[model samples]
Target: MPQDTIPNPILRGFNPDPSIVRVGDDYYIATSTFEWFPGVQIHQSRDLVNWRLLTRPLTRPSQLNMLGAPDGCGVWAPCLTHANDRFWLIYTDVKRYGRTTVGGASGASLRDFHNYLVTADAIEGPWSDPVHLNSSGFDPSLFHDDDGRKWLLNQLWDHRPGRNRFAGIVAQQYDPAAQALVGERRNIFPGTALGLTEAPHLYKRDGWYHLITAEGGTGFGHAVTMARSRTLEGPYEPHPDGPVLTARDRPHAALQRAGHADLVETPDGRTWMAYLCGRPLPNRGRCVLGRETAIQPMAWGEDGWLRTRDGSGDPELAPPSPGLQPAPWPAGLEWEDFDGLDLPIDFQWLRSPFPDELFSLVARPGWLRLFGRESIGSTFRQALVARRQQAFCYSARTVMDFAPAHFQQAAGLVCYYGASKFHYLFVSRDDEHGRHLRVMSALPDSPQADAFTAPIPLPDDGLVHLRVEVDYERLRFAFSLDGEAWTWLPEMFDASILSDEATAPGAPAFTGAFVGMACQDTSGTGLPADFDGFGYVERAYAAKVG
Candidate 1:
């Protein structure tokens, strides 16, 4: 993986709070698709060492619905940009958070999070429908000035009562011909002291207006804070050297919760940045493949600040080629015969944006039915589709057909990460194991995780193939039937409890692991499950692949 070098998450698994832009030689980035669905994950790179997956612009339901939205809560941190010629974006849905923050009784910390805004002259779209913008907080930004003026910014959530509930970063004046937000909102940047400041991102350079934030609270003491201000309204200053990037003192760094950054520039002026990393699992512990998107290289100090071009604030496993001419992109599809009718922009589903009421492809044209619904930790509806485990040793497989006549009906294969974390395996029946295949699990344990495991009959069956491998924190499960021999499942599991540090002690794991296909039928009756294709590869995370 080298052509002068460049390979630091250029965008990997669960993608997180990135937010990049370029528009001229094309470079986009966007990220953060919390509860999954069609929210935002733009991608598209020309030679920042190749990338590709150009669209997911909140594909309709009046632009994002999220049915019950909860499982890290729908889309947060979007912002993508370009200007006048159009391409703006901005996001944040998050409705309600964990339950009782610790012992409960805090103030201004219940977090509901809203915030919108859209635009598109073309990044692939007729896109242009949301423009709400402001539920008071949750990583939002706009900024577009040079006198054409436009500004917004966010992270102003201060629910009072000894305040500190991430109450910093604010701004205003954005009236793109009255699309709204005009004048006085100020409070510019009060970060530093390593508080939990949110992700702001503004930048002016020469006359200096800088800003860029994300402090110690995305887990494991994350960072990235920077500040400046020559008067875009601010008394800003911090960065006489403090977090311009951080690995929280690099605990043996391989990228871990490394802050939220965003900055571009590379016409020949060279200044990169991208941010949002995390790769943990052994020793530094738990990340399961969430928070990804890295890109390094930054340097601008003649006392103008902005470090890490090797000033070593950590996070740069290979950064060096911005010199272009290395466009590599070809490797996707080893299996997924759901035979088209749409479903394979690498898959995603959950929090229903009405995925045909949960799965369908002309009913079974090539198979991928699902139907079932409700129970896989249902925040509302649940058929679960999934995709994105992005390797650390991977393997997935599928085949299903399902015949669960009872036991309240169930379907198959899952790995998941929310609804308290997951495991699943399924087939179900039970008039005393009439059909059988079981394995349930939901881990956050004692912190609350449910369990089931103990069935295994299966013979009146013809399809059911399933498989899962995962090596990084170990996960097993396997089965076959007439597909040709395989059986594992001697119980290995704890794939790091799916992960975002073990499905968060009580919330805010911001998504990661996920293996596909699920159904369920609390017995309301729908019951169906077809599947027939879905295969994933990627196990060779450095060495082990049979």
Candidate 2:
């Protein structure tokens, strides 16, 4: 990897809403994970130019149980900090959102955005189970004052009719001894005219309490808004200019949807920012890889306000290093043989924290055995294990041996986004088509479109090779009886559809695209499929593989 790529997405693929903290010479950033379980994604860095995936603290069923949690509603913005010689983490678990209902009546306007706090002695923990906080709204952060008082800040939700649902940012005192919030909650910043105020992070600098927030929603118009108050409470003045950092005016910039930022200072008294950004695909302008975490240089102005190093207010594609020794992690493998007893660290499964029910590395010795649980579109359990689509041009290949005796059972590969949006290539048996390979897609625009291509009949060997190549907006799949010869599926699917922007107007589309193995048995039988191995080669690092 070249140093020129330093500033562009220090953490790539589905890592969003970054909350960065500095403890000593080490820096850690916590990003929202949404429905992809194992909760929040945390990465550590010695130099802002290089970052390594650290640990996902929310592991066990007790800390996070997203069995039925809707898409884009699992884990929201998380704030990470170090105080009292321990790591403090605040997060929001949204059970229900948008206009859609969850296990309730259709068209119901109910929402559940529960907030919690967890403490860990080390970044990679045996972390304590989460302590429930208020559910007033989402995007919660705990600010530890210099005087030893702790205050909690979050955006209050106003679901009342004729009112802006985003309301404003609020703050309240939190008592650590009682493990609860004390004092009355007060609205600190009503936000600017940008609207949709959320994702609050507070800082105390000089003689002021500075508030940093994400406003104008999380789309292309997203921005980082800053405000400061002389006291802990009362009136806080917004920055004289508009957003401190945004790409709204520069539509052609390499990074889009840049907002939700956090700041950290080095031992040398220099400041750097960790923020979330997206790279939309050409032609379609959809960010299929989802929002990623990036770093930029920040300098304080003589006016007592923070601005980008260049003062352009736009995210830079190439940024300067944080002046620390670069301790880059060794490159990971491109092909996984599935011979190990545990799943690869780079891969994660969806919901159902208990992995025994969905997959096993020991079930079939040197294979990943997936027990068909439900349809791929089921909100509950589905036998799908995947990794993030980190690059716009990458190829994912897998070999599966499945004997689907009934039409209800299917096992193969999937390029997935959500329940209602994905492109799947699987092997199944039907009364008419017998055992065959088919390409099915659930398009975002057409909810009722559970359409499939013409089935290609196959022998009863149950051994097949599958691969999908993605080049920008085009997605093509191929298959083989032997691992040597490959045959294209003859259709160029639109890879751009698997994006947050592709979802409906007000729907929650917080997650990025994932490509991996999946199995489904709609017949109520736990049929099993064995996958020998998996390979993902991104063009950016293609030299490491082939």
Candidate 3:
């Protein structure tokens, strides 16, 4: 075998907790969205190298809500599988936190796990309405055995005597036709072994059932552990040397945390694994972009043991096979062409219930026109479009022309996580003057009601161009009277808080699953704002290397 040459974090930024499945030559992956709306992003890859967001499976209001902005709530880890010529997805919807109590009763903490099964004739679906699994756990995964027996795997709170406080992996027989578990659920492996195991995925290979899990917590100490059982019901034993993949032994190990891995074999019978990890910047332990997705080559030892190429017993930055060749940017999904009928898959709205009526995709033979909605701060349910955080260092620019009857109508480009954490440059009609540019950050818990810099004057002419340059650590904002002379704005934001640990407490940590870049507008009154001509480009580090 050739030396495993790993790609540089194939999916960078906020893409976390990846679950991948291969069907024919096509590969599909899904990730967790803690609070962001349009939960459980679905991505497709051809050679497992380059990826593009295909669609968001869960978009119905009945399926999700952003009220009180359910911190760390919404879609958890999702598993995608194809069996018997049908595609199935098993996922968990975290309803509410167990923190609030009524009267003298104490509430459950992160309890109430609701699992749903959605099946489709095609990978890209008109998926069936969710068949509520009604399971008592989260991070649900599905596996089908050779004999056609289906098994459902999940992580739930351990309720055994003396083990009430811990979480563990549970497995039960599943009936896809019935959309429910057939037999009694049994505890397979408790977090007690590794102290905090979750995200359990089972694979049958060479007549042995392999149960792989994430442990040591989802922080910097995160790792991937493997166990094997000769029979489905096990006296399973942990590998002699635990944690098949980890960053602890790497030279740049300080910057990585390998966890929540999904293993798959390519069309040519080559084994590969995709997992999430983060690259830490100076002074900031994690960037707001959160966890990113990476691939590595895996091989089975003579004894059927799984290991990486180096045999260093740890996952490396590069895999053995030549990485996926980059393909030309997919059409109808490029961020550069902003004048389209609908927002591209790369763009995502903030943590608000997306109202379809408030937005549209009108081709009209030319240019994308975004008709915005009411005020940004007026309601948590307003339409505020955004995309995932793609590159650590990149520039996003957009040209806009909007007419606001009142000064409250604001439209611009923003890097959004939830309502609380976002920075944007907007052009609003000034009360005394004409249009002006204002830069602001919406800190969720800040005492400062309005954390905005002084507004800068803009030309009365409707046309305005804005640019934001992110240097991984600091983001610099600049705007121009024309596209030529760019003037740097005084407002610079520290975007280190976008890490999985900092932003999402119980969420898995990895890098680069963000929806990637968005454009939006808000109104103080019941009015609409129009935007046009948005463009973005990833800054080449070599351009700044000198």
Candidate 4:
């Protein structure tokens, strides 16, 4: 394998549950965002190796309202398809989920789950408002049949007591003329005997309808399995060979939790799959980067089964490069100097953002001004703008001019995994401490939540520069009154706490980590913090270890 392989993980970090579609020579993929606003991240690629962030369709609050949505409970798997001279997207907004006890009762009793459809004539456009669809379950995909009929496929979630969570796979007839689902949603395929089956994608090839699903949960036992039938709604039979792709049995493999795949055919008639997989750190097997998009070269077996390049049914670390000249890679690191009025595409807020009230660009001219709303732990309004943690080893630093009149106001750099679990380094003023900078930590189930270090007095001048270095093992916080002279904090915090495993058992931490700057005035002052710049840098390392 080449040192810098191009076939694997075309997109990295927090980009999970990829649903890929190709229009002519161009390809597009959509990934889940969870509670992050500007939901349902979409990426485009011409040569398959070089992918770029295109657009997020559910930007408007009417399309997506994630306010008060718990961690990992916003947008789930999104399916993208092009048909009828337009592109169609199907997605689910999961506001609540999870089992409560042995009886299979779930927190989803509130019925906060919803599925919607949206279309656009162009890849990037003023997309149509969401058309409501049945939300019997999540991870929905739309399929266009040869007879000019449209259908929707999704997992029928069984919330009934004494039954498994995954009931079965169901299909419903969609009437394009009426722009609604017409017929009954019938049960087509229960599953492939693999429990916890979900993430269904329907495809038709050579007179057979192919149904692919992610099974064995989304954890280590995750896998992509398939079934087929002659009719759109019929008795489906599982592939005799079982799963076509998985890392569950291969614990020593570099990539883990491989599943949730979507297939696409190239102009040359070759098939490839874009799926979600994770590369865990060496010993402890903690996936700090979370699930990412990985590609595997695939082929149609003579028997109509999809097989990997090696015929071994395992994901490849360095598969043949889909036979194309390598294009220039996009810039990886993101830096915001606050020089532009518009925020970068990489930055996002916790929910439907109140742009005018929460952030300002004209206040400081060349700075981003964040007026505090709520604390970081609050699920409601929080003046936070953050970028996804795209790598395990990275450094995020920022320069801010903030003077907190009371202990309630503070602003600085943050490493946030979820609303409840984060590390904050900020400058605050108190009656006893006068003016000082501090480091605070929050962990799930910890008695000392939001623990902070003793205030380290800051310089008389209000300007402060803060930096945090995370090497996947530990996080080190540092400060500099002058840009040149830096003072390192005495205590080092564990970086693993900012991960899905460290989140509270009941909280939805399905999303990966993020880092950025934030300000909050719990004192109800609505004080504003001005930040001159924010920069993030990461080391270049291969995500796959073959």
C-alpha lDDT score of every prediction, in listed order: 0.83, 0.89, 0.67, 0.82
After superposition, candidate 3 runs with Cα above 4 Å error? 1-4, 59-69, 97-108, 158-166, 248-251, 322-335, 351-354, 363-380, 405-408, 429-434, 443-450, 459-461, 501-524, 542-546
* Candidate closer to the true structure by TM-score (higher is better), 2 or 4: 2
Lowest lDDT 10-residue stretch of candidate 2: 100-109
Residue 486, model 4: Cα distance from true site in angstroms: 1.1
Report how far off residue 246 is in candidate 4 (Å).
0.5
Q: Which candidate leads the pack in lDDT?
A: 2
Candidate 1 vs candidate 2: the TM-score winner is: 2
Question: Residue 365, candidate 1: how far off, in angstroms?
Answer: 37
Q: Please write out the lDDT profile of model 1 over residues 1-546, one tens digit for every residue.
A: 347878788888889888898888889898888777888889888788789887798878887888886678888889888887989888888887766343356644566888888998998887888988668888888989899898889887776656788879989887877788886888878798989899898989899899899999887789888889898888898888789888896788888888988999988887898989888887438888988888977999888898997687888878778777766778788698988899888888876677888888889798889899898878778998988897778888888988878888888999988787888898888787689897888888445458787888888567889888888887888888865688877887787777787754566778798899899898788888999898898857543322
Candidate 3 TM-score, C-alpha based: 0.86
lDDT of 4 by residue, 1-546 (tens): 222456567778889999999998788999998878888899988777788888888878778887787767889999999999999999999867643444334423333568899999998878888999887988899999988999988888876656676888889999988989998889898886678888999999999999999998887888999999999897888988889899988976677889999999888889989889887766456776778899877988889888887777787777767656555556754578878888778888887645676788888888999998898767778888888887778877888988788889988999888766788998888888788999888877577767888899875556899888887757888898776777889887777777666656655656777888899999898999998888898865422111
lDDT of 3: 0.67
Question: lDDT of candidate 1?
Answer: 0.83
**Which sequence of candidate numbers ranks them by lDDT, best first?**
2, 1, 4, 3
Error of 1 at 201 (Å): 4.7
Q: Write the per-residue lDDT of candidate 2 for residues 1-546, one digit (tens) a residue.
A: 335446598888899999999988789999999888788989988777878888889989999998888888899999999999999999999998876543444333567899999999988987899989899999999999999999999999876545677889999999999999989999988999999999998999999999999998899999998999899895999988789999887886898999999999989988888899999977798999899988888889999999988778989888877657767888878999999998887788888888899999998988999999999977789899999999888989999999999899999999999987899999999899889999999888775666899999999875899999988788889999998888889888888889998887668888999999999998988999999999999985222221
